[model samples]
Target chain A: MGFKRKRNDKEGDDDAGEEVREVSHTVKKSHVLPSSIKNKDQRSAVYAKIKQEKKRDKIKKTRARDAAEKKALELGEELPPKKVPRTIENTRELDETVCKPDDEELFAGHDADEFSSIIKRDSIPKILITTCRFNSTRGPAFISELLSVIPNAHYFKRGTYDLKKIVEYANNKDFTSIVVVHTNRREPDALVIIALPEGPTAHFKLSKLVLRKDIKGHGNPTGHTPELILNNFTTRLGNRVGRMIHSLFPQNPNFKGRRVVTFHNQRDFIFFRHHRYIFEQKETKQSDTKGKKVKEAKDEKSTFKGKTIARLQECGPRFTLKLRSLQHGTFDTKGGEYEWVHKAEMDTSRRRFFL
Target chain B: MPRSSTVECGGCPPFRALSFDVLGLIKVIEARGGQQGNTPKIVERWGEPDASRCIVAVSINDRQNNPLVAVGRKNGEIELLSATNGDRRAAVIAEGGAIASMHLFKKEQSELSSRSCTLLTCTINGKAMLRSIEITNSSSDSNSTDDPSTTWNVCSAGTILCSSVDGNEKYALFGGKGVELNMWDLEKRDKNWSAKSPPKNNLDIFTPTWFTSAAFLDKDDHRKVVVGTNSHQVRLYDISAQRRPVISVDFRESPIKAVIGDLDGNTIYFGTGSGDLASVDMRTGKILGCFVGKCSGSIRSIVRHPEFPVIASCGLDGYLRVWDLKSRDLLSAVFLKQQLTNVVLDTNFSGEEPTSAAANSSPNDANAVMENQDEEDTLGPVKRKKSSKDNKQSKKHRKSKKKLEEEDDD
Candidate 1:
């Protein structure tokens, strides 16, 4: 009895456990491997054809693979598997770094070619303007001019004829910094700088001395020689301005260094600055080098002795923020203290800061 | 190393930002049960009044309501118990046909002591019976007027698989020979609305089974009936729209049970065949982010507290887990060593404090105390059993301590 067997892999398949016909199941003896090989040349030809087909298929697959890889490399992306679509959850996470300020990135908007003057806080940002008379309009004009230059600067409204009121406010009310403006004809024509211990308070006294006596009536030094007076005035103003520039910005807790320019007249200017404290360096020789030049210069432009820029050298006992360099003469006749930050410090952007 | 120096120069804070923990899982207790394939015999293992059986559905009634916990078992037996003392007050209230589902009504105290509540039980044998029990305290001296048990023939069809009772005593029936959702208004004692699922693919050959869990959502403005099907989907149908479900959510797992409650049934908590308990926002049709974990067994039943937005659920896995609906977080869990076919919580228990704000504040904060006091007041005098005098004293002390702590934070 001949029967056929059935595959029962899926549902609704009724045929199973059946016997197969002997004629269909029996192997054809003439088609066996040995018998097929008896016709050697024909069999060899068939084998060659199969081998050629295999090689062609392999080469095609390799070419396709190479082409796909080359395209992926050119596009800066790897080919994803030919499957499901991607979702937002598959993207890379975001960087969480916060940005901060950098010294080289200060005045980001300005040109960088010019040599920038770096400023540090020597003391609170303060300045005083003294003239010949209280109502000479020079003192008021100067006060207004300084206010116009830095809108945040404080003016005490003290008398040039009398320095007591200015001194009392500076000492008692805890002002950030003090400036004393006195006429050139008064005694003690000297610019003084007094440093306070802890609190933001400094005492200053500016006294002007008579240079030449009047030879005419009343014998009062009214019409003094302009040369001597101008020389003395410029000298004293230069020293006082230098000292004031060395003060700190009162409100800044992180004050490090500063660049200061003091203008007295059209011909003379005083430049004093404080640099960031380098705690480990031996600073004795540096401070002496700057001080000696200032003393020797007197009124004339002290010869640049190549003794390094007259920097306000730091003494380590304190967080000695001192002058880094000094260049005195007249500034570009800008007629005002041009306040601008250094280009290098201003160029840093938030993106570059993180990088 | 030098890069670190550059970072130091930039003056960045030496610490990381803050983070908060969302899920507060205090404890986890496992119950006894094994994963097994679906079979009629396996399903029958739960219907007995054995504590080892899974507690499928749970509910805690308000103090004034004094609701009872009616647990429907896999074997089609229901056990009514008192939630307050964990006492099995009624051993076998009803038995016989394979129980597809059951629910106990929210009742007033007068109704509670008098058993003036309706309990709806559905069977796989195409029978839906509404049993009204006039509960009488055996310890009480008062004479009971009404009969203790009364049975009403609600509906008869193929398996009367799922049934839901609304606040108005309306019964919504889901399973039968057809995919049609049928509602029987218990108030009117008649079938009001019905909807049928369209035939599709392989499912088209037979009418879709009735929803195992169904409820009326947003009962205030728009009355929407939400039904959970055996096919693992949650469908919402506006009663105003000829009973056709308006939204169907593929919840990914079969929602074996569902309930609507809390401020117009805006929140819906349901369980899955995979022992997963989840909630849905009916208004938005969005799944509230539920803290993920498995109950000891497949959640066979679920019920919401009558007053508070809390849910009590039980599973074939034998564990009973309580959930906070709004937060969708597991609040507490109790292990029932045996498969919990049905579970219920009595709402008579005190409410838990709203912890989000107070969670960060010191316990003694005066504002927290005042806020809690305000909540107590809102709960009404009948809810808080403590005398007013004691509450006032405790309030004062708490306020003072909180004030002191606030000063410290400042």
Candidate 2:
């Protein structure tokens, strides 16, 4: 049976070699075999030679083994046990150990007192917008649009600035945040927002982004900041409100208007809306023509009215901002937690005065 | 740890989903609709619990517009199961060793008016065997007569960790622990390259680096291969352009375990040993974002929905979670209660009916109100229906969890 199997295997090898030679003439003959056998006789001769070579190799191996065994017997020593094949357990220790970051290391270099003090100070945040070089062409339009809403924002062209240099420049200029827009296939996919001076870099995946002009406007800009800012948004709701508030601020501050509203975030939640308050007179009540006409006339009355009411209303586009990370001081690169607390359930009934 | 004994998203209806664990046990889950929570029900259970014969790799082929799941086992056995019914269709044995990876491709010949499906199974010892499954007739009853012809070639002499066939089924790529990336032409049945080592950097290192996972960029014309190394580096090689990698970027400190490219070929999603799944732009190497929640173990497999913007992933944590790629929000999470090694989504199974039903119904409906009241009663009946073998397994899982917690405390 063994001899027959060997003959079959030799035939298979010859067939495979012939197929390869037929398909590709560039294949070197030496690589397949010493030389190509032209006829059946030559092939049989080559197979006989191969068989003889294998027999010789087996004889040599057996002679060597027998000699070693005789020597061991002469020395009155038992032959060594057969070698064991290595298993997976043998290489199990090759796996590298992973280092996990702890809370103390993440919050290093910053004290509780300093963090609280920094949080308490309510200053106008200056933001610098940096676009990734690969998406520079579309970055300008996005920057200009973002500037229309954020008065303190400035655009930094790509290739002219490096991340380290820009961070240092922002630190020197006392910029509060640096927003980097990363594009995938020339489309804006994410925003990496880093809080300046001290660090808390947040990475947010952007989706469903719409320009301020695209979203229907309810009322014109008040041209005056609100006296009191109300922030009642939490979790994902707060994220949306934060994005909307980000778009409300103009690129260039309106000194003549002197009125601005800002939504600040704390601990992954929007804390409150801040604005300068301005008083306005209420409009006089007009006849309820639409309501009366709907009730009296057979035809349905349109819900439109000629008279308008002059009342204070929250103004701006609503946007959702996802908080990604919270870091400590500027230079502690690894000292930050990327995980944020997410609410298990959304409370739709929560008080949200500013939609 | 199990929390509250109730599933989240109570108002959502159940969808048909399947998950398998390291013990070779496959569980089919049906989502429930209720106000108390959307608890998943085990609709079916199959596969044996043998430690030595665990499943290592799995792939779902919907090429013929019908879903067929190919499961590879640790003992070098490949089993084909019907996606809709979980019935065993066929089985084949390859060279002895654990099956490392599997890919399904379809070969159609217009002249013969015949279509044949090919199953590529790569063993840990670096033998890639291609099995041709020929359907004799279109009728379901004739499926048993399907003949499977296998042809195998040695892609490498060492362990292979990952393997995949190109979109056109013309080329196949395989890489593993000690082997550099290698490509084989399916038509020629020969290696396309002679390079024995991967593209090297200027840093002098004597030892050869190993690849943990690899994927083709999905562009037939580009012929680019992206591989994630054990050294936390992602390298892209254009075979036609150069022998070395054209671009290489260090992703993170953790070893990447699985990788897949997006449809557009400009973005690549990778999962690491530390349970981080993120995407990076292929052109600029900028990380788009990371998907968060329910990822507590090293990710093993990630499959993106062909039509939807959702990606399903399974890992050692024994949970299969789906996430929206655009928003990076977890859409759903199912606890399969086993160390999951691989997962593949059945794209042909449209979950619209169940999902839409759950979405359309209001939480205040009378049916939901009644179901919430009797939620405990339903749980008792289901528990009683489970076989004694499954009951023992569940108890073992609980005991293991308790032991893990005790170790953590110590």
Candidate 3:
């Protein structure tokens, strides 16, 4: 070992002495790009060579680790712990509004929230869907798609009516919620969700819409209620928004329909997606199979009941919604007080998120 | 509460016997605290960090019940506690979704029982109820709404965002977005007057009318009221003059969230939705300069110490800030961790715990206030307790949320 170390040091000294362009004192000398090679073409060639060398070195290290792991397995030893890569999500700033599982106050609040009656199946959800009075483009088409997506939703044309009067009309008619799809120019640009009777109106900026016809191989949705899935709604505001959205759908979903709807929130943007899940049987990899797995795969290849593999088929009309403001009451835009308003100044830090 | 063992600002009880002077501590950091920055030394904070529910409504104790504060949480639970030491005495369950406002006032039923404290709470659902409290000789008090009380639905065209009782406690005013300012005569149990919308501007566009905050201009005259609108306008209304506001003044662009009048009646302090807190001369309809220090979030509540020359403001910024009223300097600031919906000053906090802290009693040296060192105890206040959480060390206390109807005494 001493002889190998002595020879490697002598080789390093000889290389540093020959490489005269840049003078540096880092422990490792191989990684530094030669500053003296000022020629653009030469520097590019040297950079490509270094990149290839680094790629090869990484592959070699992974191969060595795999070999060691195989040897350990053969000797019936413990495997190395998995290394977790650091990402922005994993290193998110601490948010005080995040909900805890056993928070009694939060649970109590949930019991009394506006959506509680509908979500608990005490009363059926009655949603009234409408477009702004002067909606253009695919507004009607979007409303039709939404009518099918949401259970027990009725289409109500705005028809040059004041929003307050509409809200009053809906209140008299016993509508649980009202969804106003606002279109600007030629596209749906905003959405207003107002919980009825007692309200907290949520305004959202709609963008990146993709109609079902736009998506290739999109499956047609069935009349059966779609199972709703909400993800990453952990903050207080997010929880309230989730509840408002949840109340729009029927509580009793027919699982036999295999239809699914998802609202996934990431970095304050909520992505809406619709899909149908199908259970598929796994195709056996006989070459890699060692025992019972091969036999089970072969036996139940045609059957779907015992299959664990699930596949999602996209059923479209997907869009992204970003919360613009949450008003304390119904759609009185001119005078309503906003519970939380998104302002240009609020986006001071990229890591700081309200929802 | 004794000095639990004072070790140079180590541990001070929430209320009285603060081991260290708060101003001295802030003076230590004043060099770094920055001028006009959040520099006030916080003497007391009510709740813990990360509590499930934040304080939505707070009413200062009446002078007779000095230092005993009535706090309403978002989940509709009101707890009566000691302002200085954080000792909870009783609790009440209010309903109709998040408490929108709470007012502590003196309800004089008859000439016999001169002054009885009444607590009125209004929820977002427009349910308003007034509960009168009684002090029993035996140390056990129970009240119920059945005997005789006031409970009514506001039935506002829009959601009721805020309601305020005059300093004289004779009337209550309510206003919100789409809801005009309506005054109710407490004695008559009827509407006294309602505001009229102003005529359309030169462009013939009717200006939006929404009252975010309103306050009585004088302690003796309930007719004169100062209102802050969501349109960023501050209007002074004199009921004796006309249904419309007498003096109209427009402040900064953001909607006004809180409005409070200084003792002078004409001088008003209003905090805007954009976290700008400034004073306005009501009589002249002139804009006074802004108070020093900036709040990161919208301002929700503002309180003036009746005895002290200080003002404390808190809001969505989650900070409790105390400012020198005269100098407009940020005397002290403390981040309470949870976004504060309302703040109330305990005027008689300078007195010991037994005397009770009075509201509206301003003192010069409010810096003597301190915090509760148990730190962990604040978590309990966040959760609604159905049973009266009688301080085990103290004698028997009032039952949770009992309304004492004057019938018992009559």
Candidate 4:
């Protein structure tokens, strides 16, 4: 009995100790979050991923809504119900092929020669990108892509009428020539590319190009009228480019003593003598005379007689581009009966493209 | 009746001999010799590397009945220190900015395990963070696990709450520009809900850069909020109305540092930055009385005792003054080298064995009692015979009671 009593006591003592330990252990484990949610880092990552996905979906919906509205407005349909703008809408559709490598074939073997050497000899080609601002991410993407395709060529993004940042990039001595893809009317936004040369010598040279007379309206005049301003800027830009090349190669070091010549077309194109390009004008296919050569052997005197009837009708001012001392013979597109303007009119013609 | 009972100060007999001085800073001077024992010097020092520039406001945490000081620093750092030992036990850093105001909720022993005790800290850059650190100790584990501190940014509406309290899941933050009071919750960490207060647009016409103070006035059947503005005005907000303030009162000539004094939920003491102290009836919005106190500088903090009718005030002048309501006289003044942004007395031991040597009224007072008690207790055997005579008187009374019972039966 004594032995049994002692054994019972020992058993009780062991049970008591185990109970205390178990109670404390249970309490310690109970306060913590469940095992499934223990890893906060993983949970937060998943939460952020979900949030990003939601934002993307919202943007897509907003874009679709905007596109539908734009289409409805074009069709003259009733507007959609009004609502606050929730997500940002993507307005511009990216056309990758519009500025891609179809021109690469023109410069296939030109990689062996330096860009300056080839460009001086009228061998290397240039690709022009029309842009209103350098801030757009798309503008950078377009330039980088075109540069990858066309080697030994300069990529010009139509700069705003301020030429500072653009002039810095183009005047780096590495570039062959920066072609501002601009129309010579309406103060072409592209002249900004030519206006802002950043170097100390560039400021002095550009001061001569500033319009001396202030126009009555928009007193801060780039030139005189919007059309004249564009034309004058283009002309001045051409002169500066010629001076830069002249200073670079004093006697046409690579071009066998050929001097840079400038020319303009009725389409408002300003190209140098050495810079040859494939001019592909996309025309409205309004007529079915698709395979005919439309060039007519009419001189300036004959053209004036042909437009005599229209002039008598007094429809509107017939704008024209005038050129002085043509250096090269001009070519026309093979098409039908379309009114054609001579490249000379690019400088002096008062006529403009109505559409 | 004995005028003062021989209250047990821990196992030792109660001795009244502590003296406190409040000049430029708080200095606790203890008597060298006492009947019980010599009391140790009590000093509580706070602040870190950037103590001078970083500290903006300080408040006493009298709820714990212990000397817990809440300090808000310029870098939005909050620290709760053990006032007895000057140990930085709990520290919190909010988003970087200058801390505008701070308050520490009293911890209840029954709910000690709960993460309900919160430090509401506000920054000048329009941010309010309610930080809670829950300390849990289990009987089974000798090793303790301190829960990681959680802080929630409470100001998303470009507004800061002057005073905020978290109870259970419901938390109320009151005061913003234009008298806009908001009561929100940690449970709804997404946003702050507008907790309605009276004359809702009181601040609409008047723009105040600072609100003096705020307190929860009525919580029984009706939840109410009280806010004091720099314009010497107090506004009471009823949560149920969801509209303008229930009542408003112009109670001070200067900004009031308001504090709730009683569990009865009626008494509130407002200490002004200009040395004006006012007590107001929360129910009626009437000024009960006002007094001028020792405030050589702007009063930065005011806190009432948790269990006693005692009020402690500290200011930029580097002095901490304690007031006894019964006498309306200065109880003690502690002189500190640095400005007293806050001052809190440790009353946790007020009910416990008073081991605090600083509690003696004067050094001589403490020495006299300690020596007397030591001598009396050591001669305990001699007193036993005297105590035995008192026991015999009790026996005599019992014998008489038996005789009286027998005579009544006859």
Each candidate's chain B TM-score? 0.59, 0.75, 0.70, 0.63
lDDT of 1 at B329: 59
True contacts kept of each: 0.00, 0.00, 0.03, 0.00
lDDT for each residue of candidate 2 in A213-315, tens digit (9 for 90 to 100): 4545333454332322334333222333343244223334444553445544433333322223344321213233444543433332233323344343333
Query: Model 2 over residues B1-410: C-alpha lDDT tens digits?
Result: 11131223423333456677666777775544333335444556676565455788888776535567778887776777777767776666666677888887655545433344577777788777766655433333434333444556555466788887887888888888777788888777888863345534478654365778888877564387888887777888788788777777786666777888888788888887657789888788788988866454568788776655667788765567777788777766766655578776555543322321333344336485455445544444333433553577689899999999999999
Cα TM-score per model: 0.36, 0.44, 0.68, 0.38
Of 1 and 4, the candidate ahead on TM-score is 4
lDDT of 4 by residue, A1-355 (tens): 4433443455456666567776555444333333355588866665565457557767988999999899889999997887865321112122111222343311221221123343355533332333444335433443443243223435554546443355455546444334332332222222212211221121110111111122122121111111111222222223332233232221222232111222222222332222211222223221124435333322323443423211111111112222211111111111001111122222222222211
Please report the TM-score between candidate 2 and the true structure. Answer: 0.44
Where is model 1 more than 4 Å wrong at Cα? A1-355, B1-67, B71-80, B86-96, B107-118, B134-136, B139-156, B171-179, B199-207, B219-222, B253-264, B294-296, B305-312, B323-327, B351-410
Report the C-alpha lDDT of model 1 over A126-234, residue by residue, as the tens digit: 4443333433433344334334333234655444434445445444654434333333433322232322221112222332211111212111111111110111112
lDDT of 3 at A216: 95
DockQ score of each predicted structure, in the order shown? 0.00, 0.01, 0.03, 0.00
Q: Which candidate should be chosen as best, given DockQ against the real structure?
A: 3
* C-alpha local distance difference test of each model: 0.42, 0.59, 0.69, 0.43
